[model samples]
Target: MCGSGQLAVLLVLLLCALRDVAPLPDSGMLFPRESPSREVKELTGLWDFRADLSPSRDLGFQKAWYKSRLAETGPVIDMPVPASYNDITQDPMLRDFIGWVWYEREVVVPARWVADEGTRVVLRVGSAHYYSVVWVNGVKVTEHNGGHLPFEAEIGDLPQVHMMAADGRAAYEDVYTLPVGIRTVKVTSTQFLINNKPFYFHGVNKHEDSDIRGKGFDWPLIVKDFNLLKWLGANSFRTSHYPYAEEILQMCDRHGIVVIDECPGVGIKDIRSFRNASLAHHLVVMDELVRRDKNHPSVVMWSVANEPASEMPPAGLYFKTLITHTKTLDPTRPVTYVTCSNYARDKGAPYVDVLSVNSYFSWYHDPGHLELIPIQLNTQFENWYGKYQKPIIQSEYGADAVPGLHSDPPVMFTEEYQKLVLQGYHSVFDQKRKEYVIGELIWNFADFMTAQGVVRVVGNKKGIFSRQRQPKAGAFILKERYWRLANETGRLPPWTKYSCLL
Candidate 1:
């Protein structure tokens, strides 16, 4: 109880304060250290999951599943992230029949490594089917609705929000995540905030029917598809009809590819039922998507339906309702629905942030109608502009090229023909139109898988590249055009023809 004793007490207090400030090195796991601030966390490990038919039913997930899945004596099953059940299940359920699927994975953060201001950690999810709710450690940090987009959540601070009690159960905000110094996070559609600012997106229409993976895909194949698109100057990509795997979105975040996430609810014909069912399903997916992907910077738009209700009047109402639902969940991004050529110019079409039209003037209309192509194409853009006066996107326009075919006299399959068509198309786009044509994304970057046996040139040659991901001579022309645009530092002479480069 003398001077030495008081000095010892002071020393102990100082050491405790220092421990708080400089956590042990092991705590580093709590704060993820990845480049670009948006690199997706590798959530591609084992996950305990079970399916539920009634999404509306009050089926408990936190207690039974988590306890059994995490039990020492319980069996450990692998649930790879960025993967779909149908792709792995030998006797998979039909796409429409899949209901609720519960997933349980343990999340951890070392005690010393709590996220400080400079090092913020986020868990990102690429896509979930219909709907999903994520829990970290043992607390629900996020909830999401849509399935086509990405979602994220921050889960670091624990003592301030929750603390371990004598009973050994962690508690916070009434819900719990996992129990490993782990902070729980949940994601929902309304929360997919981008840079704290709502983002408007533009990108290419993507279909996932590959010759290699068919409609089913794994993580590796997904990454390859993404890499191919990035090389072609694509900033954004759409899933077109179905919700893609979570890995695809994760790859986009890593490589800086913005995704326009869509759902699996394509070929939807019945609009009356769709109004109730599709709208609810789309919103749920949006909720999950925004919640999980909110932290990623690459996502910018939400597309609810693609070519819906092709020949139905209620299609208008369905699209209108879906857009409204999406905005309600997350207004930070614009909403769009891709319509067939016939309905794209419909006067009664609902309101949208951007006016998108899918036209194939150069294809199907008449191959040799070079002179008339511009007149017809420009009119479509003008018609949408005259009514909406909103930013217009010539969303889908590209021709198929046969592989191994080169230029001959009359040169139909040669690079010469490809360049000529591109030149004529750009000429039309170059004209001063009333509507603001912000950008144009061709229908695809490469040939995709089509099961209906409707593809040309042994596949959907509509892509500049083929299904093997090979350049079909036209790819060179595209690269040249992109290079010319990138190199235009000043008043460069009206860029020369792409054929000249060859």
Candidate 2:
């Protein structure tokens, strides 16, 4: 062993995702050094506070104090946050009032943050007692009950969870019900069979992210995405990188859209994170995820992690235990983990029921070499299937295409380049899909917010759809390709002949 064994830099997603890849444009800075993708802002200081003192105790709501300055509505006392108002104030009425006590703090947001639409501003409340609601410029952003643990809200739009409860009792009996589709999913060495027929994973990887709302769920966005999916004839999707909202899975169940439910196991890069304690926590998350999602028939597989550092020695044991625990929880479904590691070195490859791999031949590996994709992609599939003898999924593949970007001869980050990348991958898939490859999920369903960087224009531009759900040129390409898939393979929707949704 070395005398001190100290390292200067951390290598994340190292060796695994980065084989034969181009070098970084710049060197790494030391720890705590700021980069384009990192940011921090604190909201702590003075606020104006006033308790509802009128007899009815609803003065703030009635007068709409959130509309304007709380000081203008009534007499306000200076207050400091990070301390409870009841404990800080001297007046007994202010201390004992069992009503709305409004606290307003005026903080200026830099114009640069607003001008750069890709920048995401989040408001984190350290602690708010009992209940709280927040507003800015008369637009409600968030509300919460219980405190101590930090809570955050995106500044653009209202959270949909704050919707008023509807009285369903008037329309129906107390026993709530939904239509359930009964189906079966089976996996063998080279195929995924749904209801006794071969099935292909022709779908997208989705995130519940959008412009303005961020991760805030909105009904309009939800319905529109579903419509878009239908129009593309997409039969399935992976709840990529992490689980989506429960309502999304329910919609999948209703509309015959299949799902590969994944947990929040993306970027398990730090080798130290594969310790026993971390593995135990990972198991607990799997338990909760399976318990929540086992009822949905649309869920064909359980993907425990995405693009983990499986080449690390500890990964074999970690993924083995994880996949075994998941199968014990729900033996009806096959379990797998997504890997971006090379087949020869990926330690976790042998244990999963299906071999799911992600690679960008022309994109991440050999940038600007579109001709490299067919040979490289075909070799990738061959090597994986030869070693594992398990059905393989091209879990993720796509190029970043900035919306409205065009190039006459195809160039990276342009719409035409993205189209060429897909065509290259498809050429390989057309050769292997019927033989051994069972699925192909595009890198993203839509563009999503990411930590900003030079390569990312505000966010990852890998989606076929823009962040606003508008169709990019690639969308039309997928639309045509998927429709052809539907025509050739009628069982793409598993429930194509049945009216399973009520």
Best by TM-score: 2
TM-scores for all candidates: the values are 0.58, 0.66
Estimate, for each residue in 149-238, the C-alpha lDDT of model 1 and write its tens digit.
Answer: 555566555223332222333322322232122112212222222444322223356766555335444656666666555445444677
For candidate 2, lDDT tens digit of each residue in 18-80?
112221111111111124453455444566777767787666778877777777887888765
Candidate 2, run of 10 with poorest lDDT: 9-18
Cα RMSDs, all models? 13.9, 18.8
lDDT of 1 at 81: 49
Best by lDDT: 2
Q: What's the TM for model 2?
A: 0.66
* Candidate 2 backbone overlaps, count: 0
Q: Tell me the lDDT of candidate 2.
A: 0.73
